[model samples]
Target: MTKLERSQIDFSTFMLYRLAEHWGKSVPDTYRILDKANAIDGYLVPCYDMLHTLGSEYLVNDLTDYVREQGICI
Candidate 1:
């Protein structure tokens, strides 16, 4: 990938980490949810589009709720 794409992936991963920490979840678990919700053709959605479409707060909240309801302790 290009440097810009790599940077965006890093930033997106960091955001996922923050979201996981905020919800007391493992990063992998959080990633699974994000992947399911936003992945396209085995890749994550672009960071800008993801943030614009779902917003960080809403995405975290929705994933938190879903994880809690599913009782996914990991």
Candidate 2:
């Protein structure tokens, strides 16, 4: 991919990470939901898939840390 595409990938991954936190959805489940949406709307597929695949584990880890840090006591 070009530099811009790669950059966009990184940004989109971050977006998905935040989105997962916002919706209280896990990485794997977010993929299933976004994958379906992307299927119905092709334009979002690349970013969505990249986010779902590339950032999943990291997002989960980051989210765990965030929750722990916040001390929400969930």
Candidate 3:
């Protein structure tokens, strides 16, 4: 998997949106959860470690699929 840059706000937001959709939670709530869990890095970047900590393998897989579909190179 490509490493997503911490500066990619649009990409990060899209991931958050997709995660929220998959988890059936509101976007803000999802952010809150990640924030509380310290899963988000500075600048709101989400990493593989975060996903693993959250036990969100399905979400990670979905994100990979989404990135592939979008042709995003990290």
Instruction: For residues 1-74, write the lDDT of model 1, one tens digit per residue.
Output: 98767766765776688777986779888788666655322333344445535566776665556555655543
**Per-residue C-alpha lDDT of model 3 across residues 1-74, encoded as one tens digit per residue:** 44445344545566677767766879898666555544445423545445434434565465545544545432
Model 3 TM-score is: 0.47
**Deviation from native of the Cα of residue 17 in model 1, angstroms:** 0.6
lDDT (C-alpha, whole model) for all candidates: 0.61, 0.53, 0.55
Clash pairs of candidate 3? Answer: none
In candidate 3, what residue range of length 10 has the lowest lDDT sum? 37-46
Candidate that scores best on lDDT: 1
As for lDDT, the candidate ahead, 1 or 2, is 1
Which candidate has the highest TM-score of all? 1
lDDT score, candidate 2: 0.53
Model 3, residue 53: what's the lDDT? 42
